[model samples]
Target chain A: MDRRNNRRDAEGSSVITANRLLDGRIVWLAADGQWSPHIRNARVYSNVEIEDALKEQTASAQDNELVGVYGVQVSLSPTGPVPVTSRECIRAGGPSVHPDFTPEWQERPAVSPA
Target chain B: MSHAPHSSLPVGHYAYDEVDRTFLKQRVAQFRDQVERRISGALTEEEFKPLRLMNGLYLQLHAYMLRVAIPYGVLNSGQMRTLAQIAQRYDRDYGHFTTRQNIQFNWIKLEDTPDILALLADADMHALQTSGNCIRNVTADQFAGAAADEVIDPRIHAEILRQWSTLHPEFTFLPRKFKIAISGSPQDRVAARFHDIGLMARKDENGRAVFEVYVGGGLGRTPIVGVKLRDDLPEEDLIAYLEAILRVYNEFGRRDNIYKARIKILVQALGVQEFRNRVNAEFVAMDRARYRLDEKIVAAIQARFGVPDFDPAGQAAEKLIQQRKADRAFDFWVRTNTHAHKQPGYVSVTISCKPAGGIPGDVTSAQMNLLADLADQLSFGELRITHLQNVVLGHVRQDKLYALWQTLDQNGLGTANVGFISDIVACPGLDYCALANARSIPIAQKLSERFASPELQREIGPLRLNISGCINACGHHHAGHIGILGVDKRGEEAFQITLGGAADQDTVSIGQIIGAAMSEDETVDAIARIIDTYLARRTAGEQFIDTCRRLGTAPFKDAAYAPA
Candidate 1:
């Protein structure tokens, strides 16, 4: 199981961070659902890409290559160099943004590789 | 927990039978597949949103909300159990039953939604079109077939609309969402006039089922009672008439701005007569021969929803009545909380969600299970969710009243304040809603606390208090006897008070804002002052509205506005 070629595992998916304009301000969600400008250059990969990446793993790497892949959909502020792959976006309009509560208040789970 | 054997899922919506268990299985699988696709990114967000919405999953505030429709507010034991399971397993161990005949589970994750949908589908329920701009859950008199004043069962029409609107290809993408309500009863408790389309069941000259159609009425921004578009439309043309209206709305509605997109705005902009004519033209152009509902189809749906059989003898309930009379609490509940049923042995039971100063419409998972059991054992597997956010066991026997009341009391739903002052309707204003300017639940809670004394509320007589976070009016402030609308003034939250609005059969008046905005604390004081003035000015036996009308806003205006 080559790390990049194991299908059904979330790790092989590209790590993409999304920058969104919500009510005129840019914000994003961390792996823990916290929103801050500090954590820079986070990336995520979609399930499809992860699956494709896993399929290419050869027999030589079957046992020791990919133990488990974890995947999560995330959001972030639109600034700095964030490793963002456009494919893994879950909520296109940003992570269920609300007018009342800040992104930090939301408790989102880290994308665990399935 | 005891459970029935798994049943086969039905192939199509039309295959649903009252006794059929299999259809639930297939429907759950279908919705589950849709959910998986959405999560897997196989479907685009745009594509997935509608799919999720149809299954009652809404991405709101912090998490996904699953709104399960209780068609015509009817729910049985097994269905309730399913909801309870979803609450415990997927949601925040609680669900909120909405003013419309539906329940919303907040705090659900996107990945777990498919499993929730599967659970609901197991109970023969789904959250179809509960949100997102489409025909909403068809509401009817909660006491529909059971109410004594009902001319005919409104559920039949509701079912018809449900079928017509389910994945309706043509009207799916409307300018804005739509809501249709029907009532067979003359009491008008469902507030049909406030819906996008209100259908009142009546008989024509030939003594056949004819629908009286009303259009352009809604609660948001410009609230107007639906004007009579057609006095007596034959039963066969029901779907056609609805189609005509939808087509007219789709064609002429303003889509540039979301606020002006509702059909009500279109109707208002075009004028009622012009709107009616446009709809009429569309109706005439419609291929009557193709869309005309077949008698067989109507009969099939009607067969599943026909009134439940009940014994007319008063012998069963009479003993319970006597027993209840001995207990003061139960007696009070029986007198005010229960409603008259068409059947002598049966009665309509109101499950009040408003208790002292609690959040309206919320029910714990434990309560959901109890309600389901109660509906099964006592109410013949039938329940109704009222527009007032209370669940009604529509056909409870009088003998079961005491036991039911005790259960409801233990569950925190036994408030003898159905239509009393403390039973207020408030939206999830600034707390959760994106559109809210100020908080509504706090104002509602304050009002409820101020009028917490049951005796005081009883003395106040029938009063409706509706609060909206913003002008969007989700709480339906415009229809309340005393309405409170929240506004954001400068950088601070302010409340504007309105008076003399009523959502009843005889008259429906929009409450006019009395004066300038007041701070949250000052708002409560102002409301208390107005109530004080009404109490002082009212003639004996005159209710809040009657007093307001007699003295007018002049008297209350000065008190509410003076130095506030």
Candidate 2:
């Protein structure tokens, strides 16, 4: 697979991602097959499990819940699953223009997705 | 003749006849079916993507963006009010006016597009050919009809081009998107020399209309000023000449590399003389009778754009002159925002959307409504969206200037700086656009705040600062006196500054990049230093571009990189 556009680190861990169909909100596939808004709640797949995880998420994505489903690289950090590339980081956090508009900015005091 | 209210009023321009209404209805029905098919899994996303894009539905970072074409930047108050309604009901509470004479709703939904299009069709507007490789909305000078220097109302020809290019079968899927601009005056207000095709209207010695046709000018990753293809083509031969040009481009334009697909690249690769020779050959061989414009049709279009009955006795009221003399701010706005109108006692008012530190080109639903009301009262119910991201009331009576200015001031639309530094042209960068590499709005806001002082802006004097988030140059940064391009360097946002680029005038030149890119924090100071350098070097009464030309980029480059 051509993974050039993905945000993989030295360790090849990745997460299946898409935008929620209705509002175009960024979403990641969790282990329970439901989509989560927070990237930290994403089911991180190792290099070996990546293909299967993507396949399963693709099926879920086609169920009309998500759009533009694809895989993005992530690293299993001590804190949580962290995006590798700046593009993915922007998608995970929100637009860099306004701090108040970020997804995490409002959900800061809430329960940790990880 | 008594002025009618909004409901009873007739818009002076081309209204959709039965045939036009049927065409739009058919298009909407077709799009609705396509949307259903995509939703029901009958079509794959890959298959539906292009189909959706053809109708101007773009999936941006956070939501769907719907771009509605305001053909030739002309709209009546009813149409403007309808746009406000669409923004309030269908998408976000505000819409961004684009440099291409289009308005974009950033928070649109895929399902809601068909209904929104239906609403636009009611206003005799549509989102057709607003995206994908097609003849997009034809742009013209905002002051097309009202400008005193104009030879003819270019909107008449613009409307003609719109009718001919709307879903033209052969040219629908060109190698890349095409844009055409028309200017009626010696002053190139529409940035005519920077489009895929540019048409300038002029009259022959016998007082018959002729056009100076320019081809292959574009601003993208590769910016090029168009070369004149035909100096004097008869106005009736507009369609035939355009067909010949498009045919030549469609046949010979590169389809292999996406980056090299624009007609400008082809023109550059094959030289202007060779390209013009090929186009002339095509023009000679074409069936002239089939594409020739009829005189009756041209007359009808021209009649639609006929000047309204002016209040002959209209003059600057005593109160208005008193207000202007009393209030310095009012005097400044009058001097800057008002343009010379063709009719006596009439002036075109530029309602600036770029209030200090505000987002460029963004108008809220309330502001839109207010503008609609102002248009109805002051400008004979017509308004124009300028390429500079400001709104224009093209037919205001000079007597009512003070009243209109007061209303605009109260509504946060009256900024005294029209062609000044605070009046910035910026694109929706990383904030909303998916294609953007870095943020633009924040930088524009920062710069506007830094140059917020009217005294400072007046000192700066007629400097245009344009910011584009990427190399696409949607904001026309390459045209600004001080151009700022945002790029991603080492996974961080950085800005590259360009000096001495210009558009719209005879000395049209693409800006040259000065020094390396600077970080976001360093950009404001760097720009300030560059301006300081210009102030130090400029001769008395010299503009920013003149100063840059006199003293080369070396001094400005040094100032840009100099330690604070």
Candidate 3:
């Protein structure tokens, strides 16, 4: 089961994403379990692990830092973990219309201008 | 919250007495405490969501959005200035005027929401009833008092409705959101037919003021024009009539499925005759005295909305003609952006928010402050926010229009695109709204740029081009003469086009979807072709919708699906 999960992670992964409570900025779960603005540095979890992890975040310490926390399916691209769905991709990036309103990226780089 | 009696405010709006003022302060304090509880883990997100929503705070794509109601789209200069100050202080230097005649700050922090609400309350405004399942903000004709065609000022009824509907205990948690609109003008500028309850003010056979009440109309996944429930409901029985309709809807509306939860579905399920019968039964059985809209109460509300003192000798016709002929841009602005005023020599000037390549309904803090100053000087120190995402100086004397137009033009507020193809009503789609499937603002900008020529817009004539980011229909796509709905065509951005619909009172109808979804560029191109087809098929004096109805959709459909 572990070997199979490892093989699956090579092609695709998942990350936890939500809006920071105070400012309502989009944030991703990092390796240290801290909410970070940069999506590229988001900690990638396998499908099996993410289900349990998201449950914990959603149920416990929900109001600690974030709101609307949910798991985002991502593609294991060369540079970083990328959100798979268009909606997640938009949340990770800023509004396609307002490039000026988008936050500057850290860790790797912003993947989609859209 | 208590309704403000006719008090200090000069503007003919809902005046706030000391009691109303105190109530607002206490409400803000309570909300502040609720926010603290939410942050401190005393209230879970699940528990706190409804509370925050009740206060009109919504979590959008990037940040918290605060929707502040400009009740019936009316506000004083002081209120407008306060809105500017809030935009400058808490938000990203701008605010968006929505299709429902409310202002939305995009980048609000959750912590700052309480303070913002406090600031708004001081200006005789609140976000309450802007969201939630309860009856939302009551909309009326922007030109209610000023329109030449108006037989009555609907604001009296609108204000009464606003007070009655705000926090009504029985209807607070209805199956879905309920919207009500009132239009005094025969032209129906308010799109009254497309609301959950549409009330049109008119005279009965005896020439007494009465309401032609329409019920169960809505626009969303299911776009429907309301059915007439009462032909001439007596003016005094307005409250009782509305109460009966609400009681029936509240008890019977489906709560099982969100999509099927609207009162329209219930009305459709029961059939028109059966629905009317149910409403009539409730109307007849209710304790009529309890819900009576007393004449004294109505008179007091009507007195609060004092009419502006008109100038008989206003702008000189010859001088205005000279000014129009001198500059073509000024002439275009006058032709497209001005509406007829009841008072001669005066007109209601629409300050177009849909500028070239700018986001529709967006106004910067500087622009807001300037407009407030302009309202003070040019108009009667009052402004109206139109349902079409524009601002109206409803009582502008014709003489001041040229000067007002110039100032607006210099400040990027003057675009003479009202009722033109470029004046697109759009939603904050996937760009900001979490529920949207694709972005709408960028597409609107592209369309504006494509049809940038004032001459081309003039040639196209009056057309309502509305865009919705999703099927939720916040943008009122179904009402547009030509509508565009952005959809997710399996991970790709796509837009479905619809043709031959109008939201105006007389010609109200839903647009039919023309073809399969198109990419952003293709959608713009198709719209251009559709316009061309209309131009080609139209008679000498015919408008877009008339030509569309006559020619049918065959030519436009072919034009839309044509290879680009």
Candidate 4:
């Protein structure tokens, strides 16, 4: 999906994210155009491509897949894209107290559509 | 439930009339359609924010939270059962009772909310006006009908306010949210003085009901006491007088800056005397007949809430002597959690949700179900949510107290700390709230666990400790004897300490800041040190606030920041 809208304006990377409309589960824009629950599988986009990613995912939002779509600033590591701010990290991770419901913190999944 | 399937309205609770039921049904259907539209590609989620807020659906950090209004903190077993079912089915297994006499389920789905709301409507409850910049829930004394010192029942008046403010078109979009609290008793158990509009019920020279109205008193970043707008506004003119004040605020309250938007800011900007003059002028020009609170209407509402039949010759506290002697734990629980009732042989029992290290204001569905059954069996099937984030089972017979205590003790509900130091009120904070700068529950848990001893709490006497995640002061930190405010200090969570605040009937003062903010651990230690200072300085039978006021916060502040 990123190949179709491959445009990079800056070196810095970010991921498009939103909460699913029905249950409000946090999801990230996967490389295959699906909103994946795990953030590690999201396709990281550059500043210019963020707009394309948002426009592409807006169809999903229009189709009632997810809502409140926005780009979260992230840092690219060998593992995956990590959230930059504390609030986004908390959004990526569950509540500090309730760790049982949180996803694996350091676990990595399918790589972005490089 | 054993006796009936709720075919009859429970005693001491208001039953919905046909019009109320029909309106609720139509509102639910409309909300259902709205949710459907948002999902079916007609309206985007961003577009649905304002619409959802009117129906009490707020988007928090992780998920959506639904706040259901418990008007004046009054509900029956049937309502409690519905809340339990919703908590168990739609969201998590628990629901949080808020400081404003409402219940909130944290992890709600947007799709399931309509069903949850319909269930609430069946119980004669709704989430209407629970959110948004409108008139929020009108809180009142939890023990309104049962308090021994109550001069007038405030529930009828609160119900009247609920009816008037449900969908007032003019006031729907205020500069900011508005909160009003009413205290039925002379003792001001509901912290009426800290609300946007405070009404204290009293009788005139002829023994007819009247009120002392206080305007623009609120707690936030700028905490201020409400100014007295009227000394003795006649009961019949209650609605009219409130309209006058709200109209003045709607007209002159600042809207350009959100920080300066609360009525308190307006009241402070114009000064008390000038603001009072303007409100009085508005009152003089109002259409009198439309807003006149008819005694017949009040009587009708009062009749709907049928008075609980109390035994004239009921045995008093002497009946519990043997039982108290037998069970020491029950004795402490009774002393701390129960209060004097207007009835001769009954008492109002406070079921404190603050266990040793449990979450404040959180009750699991199982506990809710049990409490509902117990209320039906023992306490007239009525429940109340207090300002301090505890539940009240009002009007329990002295003889049946042991049975109630046993059931609560078996569950985790028997915490023997009602107004004690450990019965802390903490907001949802960063864990659930999107606006919080720090977490409040962990601090509350640490404090409650550190001060878990019943004997120590009894020794400390009465103390109100509150923590707010942000400066919004939802936890009423401004009114606590010892207050903890969570702030973002250079990206790290820090707690600010305040001393010498009290929101009771006798005293109403905002706390004074003590030095700089501290870390979470430092905050816990500072509170402990403050308590130690109080314990050392307090005279015989003097409470924490009295000691703080008598010596001022200088000594406590010194102790808090002293070498340690």
Candidate 5:
């Protein structure tokens, strides 16, 4: 969560993201430090808040609640936080071929702390 | 030679012994404990990722993917049934056969992996060394023992290599993942040349089995055809030679850069002759007796692969000929899907998983169940998974062929496109894979649909079109006559074309890139244009690869990049 040590060039708003450890469902860190399935509910961290959020999410990752934890570049729009890269967008939206498998389609609930 | 009676035959060909069973059981127990630790917050994700990877559990886009190794593509009916059960219980109701002769379950849960692994252990199977930078599954010709022209059963050597490489302390963490493929016949069905080590079985002047070794061939971002390291090494020295080569690679292969870590890049940088020199030096310095394989050990392993009982008289059943005359589809299926067997009144049948508009290499649980029954009834209760993403009934009786075909056709497993354009090899790209840059399944489906007509596919004749979602080359795009590589261009899916590459016989060559990358929509048109160019430029009865060789890539490149 320390931005000074991290190599990412934080040009825009960002969020900590990971796949849930149990089911590998994509999740984002909410403002309340909980893992939320909905990107719309994801806490968009800007400037100094990004570092704090990343640290909190990393600690959560260390608790074995999520796998492949990292920060994703996102831009805050009128609707929600949009992923900066197509890869991240795919991860957030689910695989292009099977929309039914997406967390949104499945109506996944936020994961409680492990 | 007189054939043995079916009643006296072994119950299971290549059945696991006590040691193998114990080893798998122990591995499952260990992994289960590791999983418990990870879940209990003792082991972090960073620490657990590699351990899970070693067990073939990968976190893909949709869910955790568990890759179960099908050793040399060989499996018994009971094992096949268990695979079906696992598909139904632990994963989605289907599994995908990979190019490396493994089965992948896409939708897996981390909590259930230990239980799933225990299930696999019941069948004497494990996901060991399927991932991570280790010696992966050792693949061989699917038609190894059954092919008429094969000089030796490559499966014995493959199994030997598997035992040698499994959990080898020194080579466990290498510069990159290593692959080894063995082919018994002159025809390169296993794509041996495109692997880290390619062993071709040959007989020397003294009429003893030996290997023609080739090294440093791979396909990822940088594709290279393997160079011959030894023309004729004694069968006993197989392990020693392999050790020497691996030791050289382990010592010098690049580890600083992930992209340049494969043995092929190392071979390229050092030059083949220099690499060979180092390997030869290593070989000479090592104590040969320690690594040299004993003839008795080889015989013991070979004995495990029990021969299928075949009818002595090499005559087709009267009913088969009659059925062929009546049903045109059956006739076509037999002509394309079945190959001549060395034994009389027997043939090897390829069960094509690539149905029209279906995802390549996908098999439902019901299909697996049906195949298990078919394998029990028609074949010798054994089936082989081919690298081309098809199943092979290696010892099906000619008399029972029609009945098998009917059952397969009913289950959507009988497509009759074995080597045709529809028999495509594609990787699970962006749809399921986390590392894929673009989607590959849709492209494969589109091509299969476009070439659905059996007559047209036959007329086009023997085209190997492989598609990869990324430069990882899991789809073996580099070896295809027409290769399509999916790349991310400006944050959108685009495909690059390659032509004039082949992976058959002894003439292994890497394809050259054709032109600029094309959008997903434009890719099919570009493929058609290249095929049309081949059709126009071909002289007489030249196959796709033959025509490409004669004219080089100029014609195909021109056609691919031609004006809209």
Candidate 6:
């Protein structure tokens, strides 16, 4: 799987799209719309093997998918909008934003039964 | 004449908002259903335990104790009035506000629980997470945003954590109970360091909010200070980091042995670093898609808890000084009873519940109602539950000090010994609590009676006498200057005394038990004997604690154990 996209790159380019799970091994998300996990120099794309193995998530997909990271991250901006942290924010401590999983992503059974 | 205490101050920080009303109605219906199911035996004791706990019902010595969550320790007159109604109707004419910023009614019957929950729900309150092995009522510095000396409003962070941890899926069944405390002020009046997880808000070089996280600290069989997990956690990673630690504890903490199940024992066994590594590892694996702490939500919450419109109409500090100069008692009260507030015209006034020869932290139903009324009148309807187990009215104006003092004095609450020796913290031992080995209230009463005179208490200076009936230490005996522990010697109740312990910013030391255990009468005589010895030997202005440290416990030990 293309794990490099998960790593912070100094160049900060949009490369390697879609989340790919390989042989029930590891999970990795892409940096862009590409379904693969491969990148050449600064240019990144879905790896040929990964693209061949997996299908597209959805037609209208964004840059990154949080397939691997555990908790959500909200960045702090000096002049931008600040986040809410109290119980009032959550009607009763539920998720702030519900991510819509693609049908394919939702249909996929667990690699191992949980 | 109101049975409840009265105040001349104006009420503050209150609103009967729409959201609160909706939630209250919903919770009441839910609880009413649960109570009916319980009565019908559809819900067994085991099945109903978690549900009842969430509603703050505990099966204690005589009956159930309904602990109503007082979020961040802020309450107005209306809420207090509701509490009084509950106490009068369901309980035995009283309620106890605990160190955790919650109020407990000890004599609640299971049958009346649904109605009690309904009452609390009407007041925009719930008893959720007040007890049981779950994320408890999130506690913060009671003064919070209002205290002038605060670095940041810790309540904001406290509120955030409360939302994050409430009904958290994986952590519902932990090895043992967990406690989290946060403070925005450098001078931690909340005693954050001694908690299971302590968060202190600090500023980095960039002047952004960062948290100093302390982990694996708690008080019980073993008392220990929390080790620093992160000196400066970036504001963004607060929830993620906390999730990581909790996940690790839930999965790996010991469950077979109840006593050794706390995260503290696991931390001690695995060592802090190893525990940290496991937490980080679990944190890294948590599916990020499901975890979302959004910017918009944070802003919305902050907006709701915005600073009150505070007006500095009068110079309270100057007036206080003038009053202190005119009246020596008022001067003493100002010095000992008042705490500095962040706002210019406001001060936090502590109404001592440690009445002479009475139980510490025990407020009658009438007194509670009065305090609630006083809160609505004198202060901005804002009250505080201190870790010392005393009640406080923050945001008191200087111009109203004399009038407030007069009212408090008329009530049994005006002890005027805030930081002094007589202001003690004693657990309800054999008289009320099931876990107690001996009676603690008697010892506390004896000491209170001996030092009941205000002049004598002042002469003794600031000292803490914490007494616990058993080693469970609900009374916090280890932190007292003269810690008295009641041990069962064979079948007889015996007292083991310790000296030179202090829970202050600069010092934290468990007291050393001196000599053999004494019988109940001898224990009081022994304490009286020790105090007499301190009085005879102490240098000028030397408090009981300083003298104990100087002379060591040797002299006291010799005298305490010797024949009377």
DockQ of every model listed?
0.04, 0.27, 0.36, 0.26, 0.32, 0.01
When summed lDDT is taken over every stretch of 10 residues in candidate 1 chain A, the lowest stretch is A16-25
True interface contacts retained by model 6 = 0.00
- Candidate 4 docks with a DockQ of 0.26
Error of 1 at A81 (Å): 24
Per-prediction TM-score to the true structure, in the order listed: 0.80, 0.94, 0.95, 0.92, 0.93, 0.77
Q: State what share of the real interface contacts each candidate retains.
A: 0.00, 0.34, 0.68, 0.47, 0.48, 0.00
CAPRI band of model 1? incorrect
Candidate 4 lDDT for residue B159: 86
Task: For residues B240-284, write the lDDT of model 3, one tens digit per residue.
Answer: 889988988899999999899988999999998998888889999
Residue B198 Cα positional deviation in candidate 2, in Å, after optimal superposition:
1.0
Q: lDDT for each of the candidates?
A: 0.71, 0.83, 0.85, 0.85, 0.84, 0.68
Give the clash count for each candidate.
34, 0, 0, 0, 1, 23
Residue B29 in model 2: shift from native, Å? 0.9
lDDT over C-alpha atoms for residue B181 of model 6: 87
Local accuracy of candidate 4 as per-residue lDDT tens digits, B523-559: 8998899999999999988999899889998998898
Off by over 4 Å in 4: A1-14, A31-33, A43-60, A74-85, A103-114, B1-7, B312-316, B562-564
TM-score of chain B of 2: 0.97
Every model: Cα RMSD to truth: 10.1, 4.2, 5.2, 5.5, 4.0, 22.6
Query: Looking at model 4 chain B, which ten-residue stretch has the lowest summed lDDT?
Result: B1-10
The candidate with the higher TM-score, 1 or 5, is: 5
lDDT tens per residue, model 2, A1-114: 124435444458888888766566778878786788788788888866787766766776658557877788776787678877656777788766546556654322222111
